[model samples]
Target: MAVHHQASIVPTKAELLAAWVPRQPWAAGADTSSLTKLGSYRFDDPDGEVGMETHVLATADGQVLQVPLTYRGAPRAGAEESLVTTMTHTTLGDRWIYDALHDPVYAAVLASTIATGGHEADLFLSTPDGLVLQPASARVRGSGTAPSAPAAGWSGPRVTVAGTTSRIECDGALLTVLHVLETTTASAAADELVLTGTWLGQDRPVLLAVLR
Candidate 1:
């Protein structure tokens, strides 16, 4: 059977940082301030539909910060209001926006992409709750299948950490790292991946790892 790859559409590094920096919690400028783009690079998302871009920006203050962004179809359901300034409405009405700290999908893809080709990296798992983690193993399965939906349950490999099974989920620019702590624990219990770097939204060199 032939495998179909989803199309990935991402803004250029310059475009991404131009749009991203202002939305960060630590952004220096006022809402009306202008930003200069420094550089950017792409991270691997198994499913091409969801594109992940890391952007670096230099503010008017001369301070640089890295901001990681996940571009998706449109504003998330209840996030419409938060979309006010963060979203850049597309022709398709597919709003490109900033989902800062807790976006699960982006984190998952970033982790998987970074883990690829690295020794001692086992499996990249995304749980239904949106957690992405690399389990220690010699051979991992489904590394080729990038997650497309948040609700799709875990279907690849069997990883038992501390007697808990885990999965990783990546949606657009968010990555979810999940650990199935116990049957009683909520299915969605997981940690978030936040982007921190020299320049706002820049993930080059080393994607500064911050556990949120």
Candidate 2:
């Protein structure tokens, strides 16, 4: 289970995005005037070292952007390029946040989750007295395209973007991380894995990621 902290965060998640999202080349047209967080999902690390969370932000213009982040106690070595920001947490202390794609641990869990058809981990809030269950945002699920060994680079190590979609080329499969989700139906091809997100009252399946 992923325990959520009810303690204060130095810089709120929205504040960090306001400073970092504008710098992204793909978010050029994004309306940074306001960033409303839609919801977030979590993945657990088998080693229990890194904290993985993927946040989806909605712009004023109805654009949905996905930003996966990995929190580390210390600075991630050799990931200076992918570092977003660092902040002090009342419960966890200092944390280094980096783009999930640049973190090997995030990639491994993400790939494995997709290949094995996994769901988001259960989350509970850590309180002063004890742990309390919190309402999760939405449901997130994944399915693997090509069934194979879920290794570290099963979905490639480096990241590249094609238009609004991000692409990661692995040894035998290609993974696509959809940055901007569209409501239109997506044509399915043979041997493809897709991750979807859903919210209350909204039954539309938003394609979050794909692997083929």
Candidate 3:
């Protein structure tokens, strides 16, 4: 489960995204004057130290994009390149944000989720009263069976971003995360492990990631 504090966050999520997203290579030449958040989903870090959340946004030009981010209490070593920015959370204090693609914790949880057929984390609000369940803005499921071993020869996650997708390779395993989402009727390949998501208006599952 992911616990959200009921405190103000400086440079709120939308403000941070507005300044960062448009500068990404995939979002080059895109108009974001009216960029609006569509939905978001979260995955729990096994250790519960880092916060993992993926936000989906729609640009004024009708382009839909997904950006995954990780929040840490302190800066991550050797991850300066992936660092988005730093912000102060009224309750939690300072936080260092980085693109999830370069965060090993995210890659590990993502791989485990796909390998064990896991779903998105449950949401809860941390209030003075106690923990309160919150409705998820989006949901996701991995297409994999239980009782499976890790991918063959898996060493660690190596990420590469090109165009509108991020490719993660772990030895022989390959997982592609779609940054730009599109509606399609195509089916997944037999050997591929897929991740699909659904939101309020989008009851139909849409492709989010694929592990091969």
Q: Between which residue pairs do clashes occur in model 3?
A: none
TM-score result, candidate 3? 0.93
Worst 10 residues of 2 by lDDT: 147-156
Native-referenced Cα lDDT, model 1:
0.37
- Give all candidates' CA lDDT scores: 0.37, 0.77, 0.85
lDDT tens string, model 3, 1-212? 99999889989999999999988887774677768888899999878899999998889998778889999999988889999999999999999999998887887777777778888999999988999999999989888896764655433468887888899887787878888887554267888888888877777788888887
lDDT accuracy of residue 146 in candidate 2: 44
Writing each residue's lDDT as its tens digit, candidate 1 over 18-94 gives 56455544553333165565554445445555444444444565554444555656555544432323333433234
| Residue 152 Cα positional deviation in candidate 3, in Å, after optimal superposition | 6.7
The worst-scoring run of ten residues by lDDT in candidate 1 lies at 178-187
Model 1 residue 1 CA deviation in Å: 21
- Which ranges in model 3 have alpha carbons more than 4 Å from their true place? 148-156, 184-186
Model 2 lDDT per residue over 1-212, tens place: 78888778979887898888777776777776778888888888888888998888888888878888899999977889999999899989999989886677776776667777887888888878998887778667776544653654542376786777777666655667777777555445656777887755447877888766
